[model samples]
Target chain A: MMTATRTKNTTTVELEGDRVVVIARTFRAPPRHVFDAWTKPELVARWWAPKSHGVTVKSIDADVEIGGRYRYVLSHGDNEFAFSGEYVEIDRPGRLVYTQVFEAFPDQPTTITVTFEEEDGLTRMVSREVYASAEARTAALESGMESGMRETMDQLDELVAELAAG
Target chain B: MVETFAALAEPNRFRIVELLRSGPRPVNTIGERLALRQPQVSKHLKVLKAAGLVEVEPRAQQRFYALRPEPLRRLDDWLDRYRQLWDERFDAMDEVLEELTQKEDEG
Candidate 1:
């Protein structure tokens, strides 16, 4: 049943069964605003990649319609990674579904379903990504879905030191 | 997470992980430095790989093994790191949402 649960934080990432990752985060805005932020090309450019990765958003192209395609290109150093997908379903301010394919794994396209709910002026967004198999999920995670994500060697020292103290 | 602990629970595997902290090493080098037989080294490495604790860093000519820092003793620990990557993006989304909310209010 995979019952282990960690202390809740601002965002929750959960593994269900073996092939899906469920991610949820809350925003202090209405669902419409949150939904618009995701659909708008300029807005997606603002948040698709984390700053720590040091990757710049090179370009974003989208049609935002049924079966419409969206592509985001990010560049890190001399390397460029692109995520492109076609819209499966789009229910504005509530639910959206799509397929995402990273250039690294061209053969495997992940189905991602996201929903936004509003409660007391806040919006909670939950997104689930279903992979082709457990192994595919693990590989995507091992590769960090992007580069420059693994922790530093010093963190390894801390992990081992903590184990030795026991 | 339990997988990670089980892989590292073995004294040899734990030492291999510790040895890898310095940098990547070829399989024979791991065997030599850890004072373990080659078969034992391969066995421990297989477990670690399954547990997501280490990976092969193959250079142009040879393959070297290295410690995977993010996938630590706790699976949730790395899950948190992964989600934190999303959190960073969502945090940025927060800014966009804020601007949208402001526009709606003004309109």
Candidate 2:
């Protein structure tokens, strides 16, 4: 049994099988608008690189079509990290399947499949990421750890709760 | 922390850790519950101990094995960071969606 942790009020993350991670959340908006916010570069900039995490959007280029590519860069002070990917499938307002490669580990790419379901004008967004292997999935998840984030557990707990709550 | 992950990656060891979660128990008890041989249980416990995941305590004639929470807590913290990274973006996306909808309503 995989132990999945829910963020109290926000995202619920599950480690599915051996090489997949499923993250899900619901938003109070229609699916088409939610899909637009993800595909449109300008709106992606408004959300992708969160300022609260000390990261700012450097640039974003999302070509929202089959065979098209997208790249996003986020900078934290003097350091910048980039993730680029190609679209594998597209079903507007319902589904998007893309292959993503973080520049840090360009050799191993993860395929991300996102689905949007609308009920009562609320969109439930679920992202399923399939990695090369179980070890690769763990490595990708541990990338933040490698970046030298050493916040005390109490501080982390508080920050996580705040993010999940607000 | 990476060592902790590697140690728990093995299915038998993972099951041992799960069994230990309820409370401390002797090696024989663990073997019986998990249906593994006593020697195999000892081997897994040694690896877990080296990884600082399990600790043994001598209680009179029997020894009790229990989880060492520190390493597990750190692992939990790491997973939280991964979750937080995406949650932050999703929360921001919520705002972006709101603005987009509001603009459409206005126009």
Candidate 3:
């Protein structure tokens, strides 16, 4: 019996052989629509990240194919933040595995896997983000990762509704 | 994590906490108000205890459960950060949508 219990939807953020894992889930309209929202740069701009003192994207480039690369730069006036990576696997309208790096702050790239499942026409999207070190994981968590993910999911919901309406 | 939330997520647990917000109450009184069996009330109390959201104190021979409020306060604090993000994003979306609608009207 564990004495300490974490809150709801609080991902088991712990060390995995020197790395950290962050897991989250979001619900949307459909798998294809959610996948498109993630893969398309224009739509990604709408919700790809969060607002930390206000983050505006400088540029976004994404190639949906496996082995393809994607990159984006987020800035707050003079402060800059960049993330770039490549797709290791792409299972059309269902699953995706990609690597991510923060160019402004050099560190090992994180491998992110997203799975989409459809139930009653609503898509359930789950993402597992693996970082290089426990320190890096803690840093990411402290850097508003939870809030960022939640906002992104909210954005996804809006995008889904727009796509469904159109 | 699920266990922590599942404990308090029930409507009966919510009612129990709401009742305790005024002050501590005996387990039997809580069970009566909730129309729940003593064993059932005890189960929910155990969960709330594990979550550190409630505590029991002995007043005479009977035990009284009281609201801690700290865990719920932490939850609100954690959600506040995300709430701000959603509010800002929605504001931006409103602007974009307005512009799109204006363009359609002009066309």
Candidate 4:
């Protein structure tokens, strides 16, 4: 088990044998802005990628449909990271389920489920990822998932404020 | 991500990625640039093809290999869980900077 603190949130990542669960929450922005910042490609690019990396989207095609496909890329300096997937379910402005394939390993794919809820105008988004194997999931969590997320959520808080103010 | 990473793990595979970084190119051209034997390059390409990291376009008898970005999108989706973390941290930093600037203004 490992614990990390963001600007105003506490995150705990625990490895239960091989299954890893990461839970974090921040208190400072409205849920709508957070959700919008997530769903919008432009807003996403601003705060996407790790703190030391810049993400350049080669293309973005999202319809927000149940069977729609979303594809994009992220570059960390000179290295390019590719990913794409089809939406299994979409309850817009609320929840989403999709399969993500990492360009690095085409044979391995993971499923991501996200939910957004409003509390006093602040949005709480929770994401759960299930991998094909326990070892694979552990590899992901150990591979900078905590530090990467700490930086991303921090940027997200700012993006929400900026979009709202704009 | 395994296939893409595995493809990138090899020196030759990394060469291919570096080439595509500028833009897509023909496999023959890529082979020439890397000085790799045509058969060897084709074999490496076979692995990449199975990974969906590279796409092939046929023009008559010749084929062109282009970096298709769909797989990267899949990686990004998985990485999206961290998007909020960076946003929150940067947002706080901005607040600290703003407060400092405001104090300077008051002074």
Candidate 5:
């Protein structure tokens, strides 16, 4: 039941019962638009990764229906990373459930549930990732994935700072 | 990093780290406070030491264990990426939604 809130953005990352990481964000867009962005491969390729990473999304094959499969590939400096998932549940513009596995760590599969709720024309998106175990989640953190992401984010921050200073 | 996570994954070891956070303590003292046996506390402390989360110093024939703080700092830095990733993605999504809105308006 540990929760961390970020003031810079309306995102809350919560660790519930040791194995789940729940992230929630509110978008100014309506629910339908938000859902479409999440489900459509072309739209997802635009925002799935931080632009500063310089990683090219090689391909996205998505079947947005129950029992359907999705695979996304990204390439960075001759290195390719792939993630694939199968949809378990789908409720258009409202909820989606899927099982995800990163090719780097195929043994550790995670289940993710995303829900979109509209309030006053704003859409609140909640995503929950449940790992096989607390150790599995910890292992994911130890995989250096966070450091790689942090490096890209730091680069983005430096660019922004330079522009602001100029 | 894997060792650190594996060490802290155990419930007893995790509790031991939480207990040491207030300050350092000897094995007997920690065992007494947590209602654990001396050997049990020592075993947990060994794992924590190997993980670089804690260090032991011999004081008057008693080894006092204290948290190193470096591993925890590394963990915090690692966790920050998760928050940052979502923030950046959502910012991009905002742009996409804005474009969609403009297109609808034009239509």
Candidate 6:
């Protein structure tokens, strides 16, 4: 069983199988409002970019329906990054499915599904990202492997020892 | 990096890496444990060695193959970036939702 790492605001992130990342979070807003925040381009532009990174959302084009497409461009100083996706499924205030591809790295595209469930007055949202492969997921990072290597090596050793003994 | 991914992508080679994680093992021992032929095991080891994911050490007449930590470490660090990216995005989304809820309550 995979363990989910929980963060503030009750957000949980877990690796599903080898190539899927599942993230779940509960918001105080209703399901409709929460769903709208994702489907509306203006709302997405307001919150999608990581604030501390100094990345600004340059433009957003969203058509929130089945077979519709969405595109977003972000800029960090002189460098511009673009990502686009096509909707596969759309169930208002409930579910959404899309294929997402980063323009810079078009080789591996990921499929993402978002589901919203209403509990009491709060909205529970779950997003699942399925990568083409484990290699594709790792390749997305592109650089830096200095820290955390020793700890991972130690864990691998322990896991191997346990497997061998069992 | 592409070489490492290509080398490790093979099922047999990946299993060998996992097996070597316990400790170094001679070619014949790895073959026996994995039910693979000696030649097959050697082929996989050659690929792994070429990719720098494994190294061989000669002791007397035998050569023991052990997993190299560097490539695996690089893979782990690469995956960490995706994890961090999602975390940051979700955090920002939470802030947005909170602000929107506040606006709705006021109006």
Task: Estimate the TM-score of every prediction.
Answer: 0.65, 0.77, 0.51, 0.48, 0.72, 0.68
lDDT of each: 0.73, 0.78, 0.60, 0.57, 0.74, 0.72
A18-118: candidate 6 lDDT, tens digit per residue: 56667687877788888888878988887676554455789989988889988887765666667887999999899988888777566667888999999
Query: Which residue pairs collide in model 3, if any?
Result: none
Cα deviation at B69, candidate 5, in Å, is 0.6
Best-to-worst ranking by DockQ = 2, 5, 1, 6, 3, 4
Which CAPRI category fits model 2?
Answer: acceptable
> Which has the greatest TM-score?
2
Give the alpha carbon lDDT tens digit for every residue of B16-105 in model 2: 999999999999999999999999999999999999999999999999999999998887887776777777788888778768887888
- Error at B15, model 3, angstroms: 29
TM-score of 1: 0.65
Report model 4's interface C-alpha RMSD after superposition on the true interface residues: 10.4
CA deviation > 4 Å runs, candidate 1? A1-9, A145-166, B1-72
State which candidate, 4 or 5, has the greater TM-score: 5
| Model 5, position B103: C-alpha lDDT score | 74
Q: Cα deviation of B83 in candidate 4 (Å)? A: 11
lDDT of 3 by residue, B1-107 (tens): 22334455577777887888989988899999889999999988888988887898998998999998887765555434434444454344333433444555599
Better of 2 and 4 by lDDT: 2
Q: How high is the TM-score of chain A in each model?
A: 0.81, 0.81, 0.72, 0.70, 0.80, 0.79
Candidate 5's displacement at residue B25, Å, is: 1.8
Model 5 lDDT tens row, A36-147: 8887999888877656556567788899989999987776566666778899999988998888877656676788899999988889899988887777676554433444
Of models 1 and 6, which has the larger lDDT? 1
> In candidate 2, which residue ranges exceed 4 Å CA deviation?
A1-9, A16-19, A76-80, A133-139, A143-166, B104-107
Clashes of each: 0, 0, 0, 46, 0, 0
- The ten-residue window of minimal lDDT in model 2 chain B covers B79-88
